[model samples]
Target: MTDIHQDPGAATRQEPGATSRRVIQEFWRLRWVAVAVALVGSFVYWPIIDNFRVSLTHQDIFTGETSPAGLENYRRLTEDPVIGLALWNNLAYAVISVLFQVFGAFLLAAIIEGLGSPRARAFWRAVYFIPSAISTTVTGLLFYFIYQPGMGLMDGVLQGLGLGAWSRVWLGDPDTAIYAIIAMSQWQGFGYAALLFSVAIQKIPAELYDAARMDGAGALRQIWSITLPMTREMTGLMVIITVTGAFQVFNEVMVMTGGGPNNASQVLGTWLYEQGFNQNDMGYAAAIGSLIFAVTMACGLAQLWLNARRRVT
Candidate 1:
């Protein structure tokens, strides 16, 4: 019988070599991603985690002291009447922004893109986009002046049209303050959204529109059948962004009214600022921030899930 002898050293040596190869392969695969992972952890994830930690503790900014507060800050958020008002304002802001910035902008973009002349299309696109290119602070200040009681442009136009009685102190009154800010927001922001929708519309193949036209489809019919469906992804993305922006609105409100007229225009962002910097309630501010984070995170996750569902379906 032939003697079979196992080389134990050979087996051991081969095993080590195989394991080393796997280790090297893993390191090579992750080499490029390591820096991105580290940066994201350091900047985004770490700040979020630290914010949550801060939300659970009360801090005296002047004295540089912090103490555990548990869920007290969150509980306080529930009891605060301003919080409820701010949430309602934010919801209104979201609803109005979606209507104008997302859907309205889509329609405007379709119309602009459908223009017979390329120069006309380009001119109109530039005109609409000018407001968005302007700084938000500058727009806010401009609108602030326009909303002035008697001297503003709105009042002048109303007076010119014999509708002077309709004009009021747009930014000073509690009943009209938030809506005024919302209007300014729509004016400044719809242009940007329309620009985005215009790009999306441009990506649609001309052949699709030609096919629709050959089937006796008019402009509106073609838009409904071809454009809307083609731009659904952009519409969905715009809705998410608009809603997030509505909730996070601060600049216009701060510049125009500072959440004034009895805090009537206070959104969560302004309210958080009011609590943190103005009132020196850092813990409560962090809690408010947490709520904002929760809302924006939900919006982002919902969009992701919708996209995934669409892909699966």
Candidate 2:
């Protein structure tokens, strides 16, 4: 016997099998939603994978045909001087940019964390992070114009300060162009780094700092020996993120220099773009893409390995 409320069909009782059948019917009606999603993915997902397969093969520029050429494209990537330059330049960029980003962001984040009040902390955080919100395209354009030779903003400002000799064509000069790109990347990247550090710092209990102070450690020593050590994992993570971004540098280069000034700022991303689109060397570009993917995975694995080593000790 069942309660009246539980017996939907009831003068007295309703069968559990009948209730289960209704539930199953409802589930069947809703199951179309899942099927539709799967059907949509079925149409698009296979083609994306097939295109990746085709990109690994040679493509005919004139006839628009493709054929498998195995690993020859990868061999060519090693032999090509331009590709070599691009790879070297990109590697350098990753090392230099990550160094700057980690040091600069960590310094700034630490200072912000030390501020006496919560509101002041937030205000400065916003001030520093505002530059990162703008599109890389717009930031590149703005800097490009600023660095434009005689009448540009940077030039004019330097000239007004009676330092006209100091103002050269910033983007046009080979020596200065990659540095200019780094400046832009740093501006965009520091915010995210700061945010990560800030979150980590906030999570660190204030009692830890207080205890360090009680042990006769001055603020500087406390930060150097305590705060920095405590936050090492976060630092490692931020370095990895910054390094990845440096290798993936593209938007600013595309908008500003297009790997110009004689490949002075040429990076792997733009090189890949040129290989796939301009040169129509899709297979080789796929090799480059694969190389980048492998390197990125390696960095992540390396970070994990170091973290595990730290935990073991």
lDDT of each: 0.92, 0.79
lDDT of 1 by residue, 1-313 (tens): 9999988877557654788899999999998999999999999999888989999999888898999999999999889999999999999999999999999999999999999999999999999999998888999989988988899999999999999989988998889999999999899999999999999999999999998888889999988988998888888889889989888989888988899989999999999999999999898999999999999889878987886666411
Clashes of each: 0, 0
Candidate 2, residues 96-188, lDDT tens digits: the string is: 777767877877888899999999999999988888889888888888887889968989999899999888778888888877787777777
lDDT of 1 at 172: 88
Q: Which ten residues in a row have the lowest lDDT in candidate 2?
A: 3-12
Question: Model 2, residue 258: displacement in angstroms?
Answer: 0.8
What lDDT would candidate 1 get against the real structure?
A: 0.92
Question: Which candidate ranks first by TM-score, i.e. highest?
Answer: 1
What residue pairs clash in candidate 1, if any at all? none
* TM-scores for all predictions: 0.92, 0.80
221 Cα displacement, candidate 1 (Å) = 0.9
